[model samples]
Target: MGERAYNFGAGPAMMPDAVIERVAREWQDFRGEGYSAMELGHRSEHFADILARAKADLRALLDVPESHHILFLHGGATPHFAMVPLNLAQPGESADYIHTGYWSDKAMAEASALVNVRIAASAADSEFDRVPDRAGWQLDPAAAYVHICSNETIGGVEYDGDPDTGNVPLVADMSSNILSRPIDVARYGLIYAGAQKNIGPAGLAIVIVRDDLLERVRAGVPSVMKYARHVEWDSMYNTPAAFAIWVAGLVFEHVRKAGGVTEMARISVEKAQKIYAAIDASSLYINRIQPASRSRMNVPFFLREPRLEQRFLDGARRRGLLNLKGHRATGGMRASLYNAMPLAGAQALADYMTEFERKNG
Candidate 1:
């Protein structure tokens, strides 16, 4: 604890200490080999084995079915905003998008360029402080697919559970909360996540897509963007992000050892409750989001007395609580307690909040 600080950045965030230590030890000569993981060719036998082990671990952890294909892709989830439409939505056909937060808005914007777009549901009227009820979604009967951002990082809203979108295939961007809880992979036609929050480092994204979706690719979609091509070539259609995928695999193993997603979900709820209770009890701070729709992964709050914002951040930093500042657009303090953040860290932050209120109130 001497040098380590509680990190709360939204993405490219904290990683498990066990993973970091192991990487440091074996980075130079992985598995008794002479070359570092970064220097090895993507096609080398050693790297191939590393990737296979990773995918195997992931498939086991998430309970992914044999009917689904897993791919380690290059671009972040940002690119899939456009790629999803290009592959699934033909020019005349429309796609349904749920506008839950900033990310969903961006996803719809990208989709609009390629196909007819329909906003099936939106929380814009609420300023994204809460998730709209599932019953309120305005679904289209003839859309190509239904897309939703499973968790909205910037707006501090998350779906408590998956939604049933009728016979329409559901596509989800679960970037911030992928392994934070258990998910039924069979329910989704496609699940994509940028591996920086609960998974691993940046430069890698994990996509679990159903086998039927492969044949539906609209012609002329970029080869690099097509899910079919990646599945056909085993995500080796081009040079993969070797090191990032390796780290993701290691993270998958770590989650499995910790008792898989069900256990992770239990811990996630406990961690969130610890901090949320402190926020609610304190007269000096307020979290605007609805408790039921609140995000367990990212908690955004504001001091009752705005003048103490700087003091609160500075004092927390001195105490080794770091990166608790909110998103600039939102203008408040956000504590992003991802999977790597221990319950002890949340309790520590809660203690610091009590102390700060005592002094400043």
Candidate 2:
């Protein structure tokens, strides 16, 4: 029971203190039942209630419409890269993709193996410093759907708002930024997020899909890969991730009590601004992404002296900040300011940055 570090890892990120405390309190016997949530069978009545409440709370927080289905599926966003193309596009039909950064590029690469994938827009020319402007997108009129990684966890680029995709369905891989802001659920045809970032833990992903898209799933696709199967079975086609779902349910409830997505968005902006401002004001650090497209959830910055990268991380750890190292592909520091990272944590990180710079600058 030592004090927890201010975690800054990209996924399996921080959870609210309140949620963690609650989970600890109920670990042995959930709601007076004689078994832990992890021990309960997925099909048990108690587990069913947990699943229902989790979905209901999430729907309320996101304002998901009745026309849409909320599914808690196993596997993270990587699976969806393949599943999306298999379910949505026909043999000859292509899907459009906006390649903003690493994750988006990965998505396109995976989908290209299964179906026709058209690069409607890409920010590779700029080293993914910003999202390509909507006006610059060369979208196909006959594309089955348009896919975008709303936020790039590695490159730290994010779309400020929803892209206008015209009649085609807009699908977003919102893994890092989902529930960090208020989004109009109806605007996107499909949105999926791995639970590790803003939701709960690893091993579960939440998929929100519009009803009409279920009808378009390729007939030969495996039942497990079909959105319709998950929807029909209430996301429990087989044994679900019971413990992860229960924890996620607790998180959803916590979010509601904390004033929902609007409040989360407000705090997210505040946290990101604090860190970005510290980086901008310093001669010792740099955030390469354009201001407009900077991610509120993941802030990747580089030290002026790359040699000090390890020292910076070591110092951060000793100061009670942890997981501040950047991704291997992008060698620098990345502070993921997810919803669970309080304003105080961001401020602490800023203070550490300032002090560290003064000593080493």
Candidate 3:
């Protein structure tokens, strides 16, 4: 096996070396069962224990309260965009949506088809360069719930504080940046994240929902769309994504042993700061997002001389830094420094940036 480069892909991104190595060894046999974790039956006792431990570890890491239920769902956070409105919003009833960036807007579009969606706040006017001030929000008194993308993976904006929605409960799609920091579960009615980013792999989404919100689903929605159904069945209403769930469980255990969310938050800040500081110090690079709202998980920056972009990217790859490529839609460069990206990797990128500028600037 080759040395893993400093991977900065946005999703299905880097995972801890230890987790990868351990999983590599266990892929041959798990817990003396003489079969890989992937081959194990989801309904078997071995997998069941693994599933339970994953849930417990995630709960402990997030400090999820007993009043909330966590589910390992099959679809990515994309499906939850529709499911959230289906379960939470009755037909003709409105829901408040904060439009911050691409994902948030996509979610609002899905919800708008099902229910009246009020634009409580939007960063559209600023070209999505900054998160809208909380004081600028115009929440609807009669809305089913207020929704926000706690972090925008594309635009790289993030919320600095808990959103205040008054009587209306908050629903958040924390897909890209979930578990990169500590979150107070009590602050939101529902928080869902696709497993591809900070969690495990694709095909599994972790939904943390308050029990009360689960009970408030109006009838006539699809049974599968109901959060209550999953809660009642322990997220196994039908056959689950067994492999993804098992891997997600291992990731949960890994995060817990590494000292939970608080430590993760600290490491995340340190890692982000290293890159952001480098960007800030360099005349050759610039991060457009407002400093206060800049994402600690994804750092998007641009070269002062746009013409040298290819040279920069090609050189990065040649230097053993992979996937530092920016999203085509929003071109330049985006280094997604998720939890699994170590401090050394960030420093390596910083060093690369400095040397690249010294030569190219």
Model 3 alpha-carbon miss at residue 30, Å: 2.2
Candidate 3 global TM-score? 0.97
Off by over 4 Å in 1: none
lDDT for model 1, please.
Answer: 0.88
Q: Which lDDT value does model 1 have at 5?
A: 81
Q: lDDT scores for all predictions?
A: 0.88, 0.93, 0.88
- lDDT tens readout by residue for model 3, 231-330: 8888788888888887888788888888877888899889899999889889999898989999988898999899999999999999888888788888
Q: State the lDDT at 183 in candidate 2.
A: 92
lDDT for 181 in candidate 3 is 80
Q: How much does candidate 2 score in TM-score?
A: 0.98
Per-residue lDDT tens digits for candidate 2, residues 1-361, read: 6998799999999999999988887788877887785687787888889999999999999999998999999998889998898888887789999999899999999999877999999999998999999999999989999999999999999999888898999999999999998898898999999999999979799999999998888868999999999999998898899999999998999999999999999999999999999999999999989999999999999999999899899999998899999999989999999999989999999999999999999
Clashing pairs in 2: none
Each model's TM-score?
0.97, 0.98, 0.97
Per-prediction tally of clashes = 0, 0, 0
